[model samples]
Target chain A: MNLNVYLHAFTGVVKREFWRFIQQRSRFLSALVRPLLWLVVFAAGFRAALGVAIIPPYATYITYETYIAPGLCCMILLFNGMQSSLSMVYDREMGSMKVLLMSPVPRSWLLISKLLAIALISLVQVYAFLAIAWLAGVEPPALGLITALPALVLVALLLGSIGLFLSARIRQLENFAGVMNFVIFPMFFLSSALYPLWKMRESSEWLYWICQYNPFTHAVELVRFALYQQLNLQALAITLGTTLVFATLAVISFNPERTVRAAPAKA
Target chain B: MTIALQIDRVSHQYGQRVALDNVSIGLVEGQFNALLGPNGAGKSTLFALLTRLYRVQQGEIRLGDDSINRNPRALLARLGVVFQQSTLDLDLTVMQNLEYHGALHGLSTREIRRRAAEELEWLGLADRTKDKVRSLNGGHRRRVEIARALLHRPDILLLDEASAGLDVASRQAINKAVRQLCQERGLTVLWATHLLEEISLDDPVVILHRGRVLAEGIGRDVCERSDETSLDALFDRLTSAKEAHA
Candidate 1:
């Protein structure tokens, strides 16, 4: 398709999604509030309870709030991913997804276009949350703000693809809640969102290994490292590779035939 | 006349139950064929398969000599579909909906706007072009959908209960428009409806029951076998017989 065509489709989706969030002001507020609670209330309770450990590239003693900023950022990406997927299910039921699915262009391209749209929006919200965090006095290197953009984009894309992949399988919107509990929670809690890998190792080495291997952990680290203006080759490689894999699987699972069987009304 | 659409022994099933049993039908160029069936009688399934939403398990589908399963994109480009549910974005104006659809088919903005204007005029909806879809009456909304389907000038137009939820006046308007398109533009039309009153006596009607074709022919002739003068009674007999057998 021509660039203008792609731009029209992309802009339509982005505008629709953005307007949806705006219309539901409470949801936008909740998106900001949820992470703020974790940073303020939850982090305050555990700051002194948890011992400080000197890790590589940690220049000085950073408070719990500063340490979990990247994790909270990852949380935003994760939630946005699932939220987009939930909307996909909702649209399918309402027969709106059929409009996108039935377009004459390749289904994969259409799906990717949607993922990119979600990523762009999610990125915007993530930065908004970060700015709010900055106002809350969670200090980061000034240069870190500029460096985290690409890392956030990569994480958002990876998570968005995973959401799209899950969306293709969900028949009803209610089913997404279970995915949130099982996937989103574990991906967040088991990773270095609140604590360090070393801290987890002191408590349980196996848990530390799991955290190290968690793709979300890599996503967080990719941002965490870049926020410090440090190169994180491992994190970047893992995030990029995982993104490709999830994207491929999402496209496969979202095969048009399966989508038809899953929701005949949508097709 | 060249065959504009062809279905060859297509069969589809959902888990344990068959949705469309081995069945086939063809629509020639410039033909308006009515697909008649009761709820759960496989009419929707057939429509889904035709739109490539569901793949055929045992048969092939061809659109103008090209296997739909092989060249879905090319086939889809030449096909227009108005689904049973509302596909129009409620928040978007009618003109905006048409613009997005045209873009998906690779139309430039100027061309899309030009065609959108022409289509609205043709559908007698030029005044409502800028109105949000939710603000329109049911009939006007249906007209917009039909106009959107024609945005790409598809060779074949598929309507899956397009008149559902519309009032009597709107239904008549849609029927008139569809008939006119078939007669004047030579567009192949597959109009799916449960109401037999929607089918014309001279129109080709395919009666589907429980995923199989129960009867196919001129509407009057098919109804005549049961001494039914109208299409409705003919459909009642066909479906009642199947229900009894089941």
Candidate 2:
């Protein structure tokens, strides 16, 4: 009810999340490693086979690594999003989530604060990966990194909300592996993360449409455009719209009443 | 005595199975009340409703004058809870965990530190304040949770199976610590457990079985009213009678 109450609660949740992130050294290493592998090794292997035509964001032709750098940056956000949700599931099972939900603030506000925290952490990983990419000669314009900040954040929230929605539906921690396989892989592979939609169309029309329709594709495009100092209005609109829808669904599903009903009564 | 917390005609059903059936009880202010029920007797269900983890479907729960349905946030602000399961973050230090709880309740850092120091000192955990909960024993972890719950300084405390997994000595220690809070601070306390040894003869008790109230009153009075020789006999007789009927 009080503004200070909400602010303090938000700060508490954020601080706790950061503490957890810091303690888990392997998590930080893995978050950086996954995308870096794609940027460094996978892109190098595909450089000859994949030719990226001068995309709107790229004034001249670019190497495979340069073209996939934004996509891989979004990849880090995507994985971190799911990783945060996995932690949520873990917290729920371990009973630590009760500490968060029991706060006097509105459940919606608490969930949004959690989403924002996940987004902020994901941004750090994104920049870290970008810095590594820059050293590897895949530099975007200096101002473009600044410009891409908001886009990366928007995509992070979108991905995190999607993860939240999935976590709310997932009853047990064991079922999460299936989600990573079904949701994360398909979203990452079916999007333009590794190959342009045009290339996918040349192979198969159906795959092209699926890639185009995936909200993750727009998220990738949004980051891709921002990193090149351009704006993609359509991608921006779709990403923002999808973020709201998923976040709303997540908040509703995560309501204590609904979650309680969904959970099997322990005693 | 004023009833600080009231559960009125509350009922809950899981699909076709009723978890709690038209249950109602009043917790006397500044008293240590025990809710004794065997597993699957709706003890956890009642705690869930009290904590707002589950919605009150068929009845109302009031904290003082505020109905949980009408103003849950206000009630939550004044209520402290330690669940049947451990809710403390094992990775965080004792002080950090308490500080987090205080911040959740909107306390400033200076106030949180002061209260954390006091609660830790009272719980005899001041020396372990900087240690991660993972490094503590089960009894000490339970104590840390108790300290965290009290840091917010709520009017009533609900501890559901707070001593479930502790040794007998640790169980008694926690029971004593909570009872001390009731006497010293006049804080309303609800201690839920199936272990009869954890309860005293004079304490107010509520016995629940298969989602219904089997008996409620002073522990000895409830036993006498049922014509039983002891609390253990009373519980066994009451719960077994229902089991036989079912």
The clash count of every prediction, one per candidate, is 0, 0
Per-residue accuracy of model 1 over A140-198 as CA lDDT, tens digit each: 78898889889998899999999988988887888987998888999999998778888
TM-score of 2: 0.97
Docking class of 1: acceptable
TM-score of each: 0.90, 0.97
Which digits, one per residue and each the tens of the lDDT, describe model 2 over residues A151-182?
99999999999988988888788999998899
On a 0 to 1 TM-score scale, where does candidate 1 land against the true structure? 0.90
Q: Model 1, stretches more than 4 Å misplaced?
A: A1-16, A50-54, A257-267, B91-93, B124-132, B135-137, B221-228
Query: Candidate 2: lDDT of A241?
Result: 100
Model 1 residue pairs with clashes = none
Residue-level lDDT for A265 in candidate 2: 63
Clashing pairs in 2: none
**Candidate 2 per-residue C-alpha lDDT over B1-246 given as tens digits, one digit per residue, 9 for 90 to 100:** 788999999998888888889999989899999999998889888888887888888999998778889999888888899887888899999888987888888887789999999999999998998999999999999889888888888999999889998898999999999999999999999999999998988888999999999899989899888898789999999999899999
Interface DockQ of candidate 2: 0.67
